[model samples]
Target: MIASLSKISSYKSMNPIITLSPAILGALVVLQAGLNRKVASQWGLSAALLLNAVVLLIVALLIFALVLVKADWFSNTIRPSIDFKTFSIWFLLPGIIGCILVFGGPWAIAKWGAAQTFILLMSGQLLASLIWDLKVEGIAVSYVRLLGIGFTWIGVILACKWK
Candidate 1:
């Protein structure tokens, strides 16, 4: 599987602000909406509901910057000069950490109780995608959109789960 991931200079183009930003924004809204709608009560009124805006905003900015740079880099450059093996390792570190949070954090850390578990899973995936500047296979770095539906569904589930 690792060898199969031998990446090519595949061009990635997507809307920097539109594609990835919405995912982040939507997630923020989810957290906020969860609070407003009393769906995040399982988590808490203070920590889970209205407190994460600044943190999420910073994350959004980071995702925005990463997507923008990646889009431009792939666009202006002929091909990626990065070594797949080494670069994969770099990517894997964070990705694996994210995976751990998604899979293990629920049963382990117990963030805001288990009622908000769906949020844990979906938000983690969204964060992972955002952090990696998630993109599909065929964009020359001009497309900017993510799985809005996925985020919405998770948000809905969480909204339901709220106390």
Candidate 2:
């Protein structure tokens, strides 16, 4: 674990682009949430999710085809190593959770507006991420981190204020 942490730190130091990727993803999530809300307003939640799913499927397929053509790595190394017997049913939770995220995001945006929804979503994500880091990864939870989480909750409350 220490080796992995050192490796990640080294890699981050070497490639700053990896650090900036999350910020880009955060902006994209906000954009996607707004677009999802608009689509939901026109087509309803289920139809919007379905449409998004279809679009994502098409894009993923295209990417996969390109990867297959450009590199023999996945086919030669990754695909051949599949062990179906070792796979658990819990592996499917990501898709189920994704569906929930897709459905709930637009609903929250419609009910609360984008700013409030984004704040609440970010708060929830921060809290969950902290807990996951501490409990699952056995990371030490510092006082500063706790204080940050408290501030995030306060922000969520302020954002949720009806007035």
Candidate 3:
């Protein structure tokens, strides 16, 4: 277990894809936020968010089906094992938070403009993530990490500043 934990901790060095995925997600979220804003303007926020959730559910189901087939994941001898007892109730939080974000994101962009909203969102996310890392993960807070957070806040401020 210790060996695997060490390996997992060093996964970024082993897999560049893992490190780059979040950056790609950040770009996609910006585009998604803009597209969602347009959809909300035409259909109203609740309808737009409902439509978005439905589309997302369809895509996810399709992807899951494709992966299952490609990997032969449901083969008799390769059945996936799930331990419901070991699963934390906290696992539900992300889905709930995601729903809230999907519902509120377009409204925020409409009210605050995309750039300001995205900057504010990013700022909050960065701070929350830093706190999670430091407290929940028991990670040491370093000067460099603090500096990066400081720079992120500065960028957010500049992005949202009025001329």
Candidate 4:
């Protein structure tokens, strides 16, 4: 992967939209958290979460509609021959966790300020990603990775100043 990336001749030739997509998404997450926090203040956490999910559903439907306009929509949609029966109960975990995040993000921001909340969130993500790399990807945890994890936790501690 590294070799493939390095072979890209020039920065100008790279796809800026794809390269910056993650940063764009990251900014949206923070913006969404703040908006959700405001909504929770006006209504309540559950109501705000419901609104968030409803808006997401509506947006997704709109996107699907746009995509459906294409002549090959049916073929594209049916191209994926997923075996539902093969999926375990674990498949539902992402939705459940997403609900938890939608519910918890605003609550956490309201309690701990966005910076602290995000710091903790990043720390959790790092740990979870490391475990995923190890167990699922069969990647070995090097000392440098351990050091980075340690620094992350230390930064979280300093940022949060837990009571």
Candidate 5:
């Protein structure tokens, strides 16, 4: 699996894209949060989130269209007869979580400001991700990872101004 992952550059010819994607994603999230907060202030939170979702859908559809044009894999591998009846209720959890983030993020930013909001959000992500790595991925936590987690919480504590 590791070998296959390391060969992603050979497969996609996008070594730089793969390398910089995370940083790009992080910057985009900050930009989105700020813009969404501004939109919420002008329009309202529900309207802002709705606009965000609509734009996201449009962009996603464009990407799917591009994939359909560029690759046979999507056309050939997508099953038209996917049974919604057979799907578990747990499948909806991710969408629910996404809605929570979409709504909660701007609200939090409005209340606490971006730095504190993102610091607390990062702490929550770190804690939840640690549990997921342990319980779901069956990863054995090392001392180094524990120390990193400790430092993250410490930073969070320092970053958040409690009244």
Candidate 6:
């Protein structure tokens, strides 16, 4: 294995968000399937339910850890370019979990699985987080996050109900 990959994997082990993403994602996927007319299965639903709780716990723990950061605003150090990592993991954790619930499995371990699921999940997570921040902490709106959420929703709807 590449040294960088190994190093990142090791670091991820320590990062709760990174380590628990897949399991939480898998769980959300199962629950969404259960609710949907197409993917409902009793056993899968149960497993998914468990995953949902885990993801929520992880997310809550993450918020709790933010006590150390001492700032709620975006960092000036980050730069003008959009950061994919921020969008994928931080802003969109919940909806991403939802997407994972809908499409996560062996086949989708790293493969292209469902576009709508991906888009909707991203939108729901990022925008919802922004809304939460706006309400809780009076966050100023950022053009990029707003744009991304709007664009992501387009992708979700197209993917889920395309003709």
- RMSD to truth, every model: 16.3, 3.7, 5.1, 3.6, 4.5, 14.3
lDDT by residue (1-163, candidate 6, tens digit) is 3975898878766879777887797567644543542322434544555565687689877755563363455455532446576664466786676555544532232244444444555666677789888998897777877897778777777776773
lDDT (tens digit, per residue) of candidate 1 on 100-133: 4333433332445444554555666655565455
Clashes of each: 18, 0, 0, 0, 0, 3
Model 6: CA > 4 A from native: 1-122
| By TM-score: ranked, best first | 2, 4, 5, 3, 6, 1
Estimate, for each residue in 1-163, the C-alpha lDDT of model 5 and write its tens digit: 5875778747577677777897798777777888889999999999998998899889978877777667655655652435888999998898788887888988998999888888888888788888899999997777877899899999888878562
**TM-score of model 4 relative to the true fold?**
0.79
Q: What's the lDDT for candidate 4?
A: 0.85
Which stretches of candidate 5 lie above 4 Å from their native place?
1-14, 73-86
Scored by TM-score, the top model is 2
Clashing pairs in 5: none
lDDT of candidate model 1 versus the reference: 0.50
Cα lDDT tens digits, model 4, 1-163, are 5754676655557799877887898778888889999999999999999998899899977777766665366666634446888999998898889899889888898898899988888998899989999999998888889999999899899878963
Best by lDDT: 4
Error of 5 at 161 (Å): 3.3
For candidate 3, the per-residue lDDT at 121 reads 93
Report lDDT (CA) for all predictions: 0.50, 0.83, 0.82, 0.85, 0.82, 0.59
Model 2 TM-score, 2 decimals: 0.80
Q: Model 3 Cα displacement at 130 (Å)?
A: 1.1
Candidate 5 overall lDDT versus native: 0.82
TM-score of each: 0.27, 0.80, 0.77, 0.79, 0.78, 0.35
CA lDDT of 92 in candidate 2? 92
